[model samples]
Target: MSSALSTVIIIAALLAAAYSLVTALRDRAMGWDHLAALGVLEALLVAQMAVGFVKLAGDGKGPDDTATFVGYLIGVVIIPVVSAGWGLLERTRWGPGVIVVACLAVAVMVVRLGQLWEGAVV
Candidate 1:
């Protein structure tokens, strides 16, 4: 996994989380802006996933728990989409709140993924 990409994703997710929190606090429902943020985040995650898969496939230099690593990669990619759908359906301030949680979760998951790639038992 590329640390630079991971850092970018983490930063972006946290920014999105902060923005979503503000929106929720203002009692606004999920809006196109929130969805756009999620869309950008999703694109970054997909890029990261692709990089991870390529690295894992090359020269067998991956973590021992390959399945777990793959799971994280896939999970991170799915999270934003699910949350966006849930947020849209809710039609309340909690919609952005849900996005905040998803963004924060993605940040943490990206960190965990890096540790896993390094073979750390976290």
Candidate 2:
């Protein structure tokens, strides 16, 4: 729910997404650096999940639609893993493309999460 944390997540996701897109456009193979970035992003997301749960439990100021919030949180946590797995399976530029898409999705979700934390609804 902290704006600072949400901003960090959004910036990180945008940076990663841009990097992945550039790599994909260049037709480069998947590399350890990209994977490492994804790993870091995943860690940040996990931390966010923890903070979010604590805040939600204490204040209950989050989205009114509990199911949607939970779904978004779950999706946010799983994206990096799913993208990394799919990337590893292909060994092509498309692998990086998958990562790019995932990162973009994460960024958007972070924004939505912020809105939800502010008691916004669909």
Candidate 3:
């Protein structure tokens, strides 16, 4: 995986997470902007998936454990999507709270992804 791409995903996820956190603190419901940010984040994740897959297929550098790395890649994509669906159904402060939690999860996964890419553990 590209360090630059990984950095971009990390920063974007954290920014979106912060936004969701603030909205949740304010007791606001999820809105269009919140969904939009998540959309962008999801796009970045998809891009990362493409890049990761290409790298792996082309015999590019990857984790010592490929399965775990790919599992994380799949997870980051699912987190926001699942949370957003549940958030919409919630229609309360908890909606934004769902986003916040999902974003935070994504952030953690991104960090782990970086660690896997760099051959670091824990």
* Best model number under TM-score: 1
Q: How far is candidate 1 from the true structure (C-alpha RMSD, Å)?
A: 0.6
**TM-score, candidate number 3:** 0.93
lDDT of each: 0.96, 0.87, 0.87
Task: State which candidate has the highest lDDT.
Answer: 1
- In TM-score terms, candidate 1 sits at 0.98
TM-score to native of every candidate shown: 0.98, 0.93, 0.93
Higher-TM-score candidate of 1 and 3: 1
RMSD of each: 0.6, 1.2, 1.2
| Residue 68's lDDT in candidate 2 | 74
- RMSD value for candidate 3: 1.2
**Segments of candidate 3 deviating more than 4 angstroms:** none
What clash pairs does model 1 have? Answer: none
- Model 1, position 42, has a per-residue lDDT of 99
Task: Compose the digit string of candidate 2's lDDT tens values, residues 27-119.
Answer: 987789889999989999998988888887888466677677777887899999999999888788999999999999999998998777666
Worst 10 residues of 2 by lDDT: 60-69
lDDT of 3: 0.87
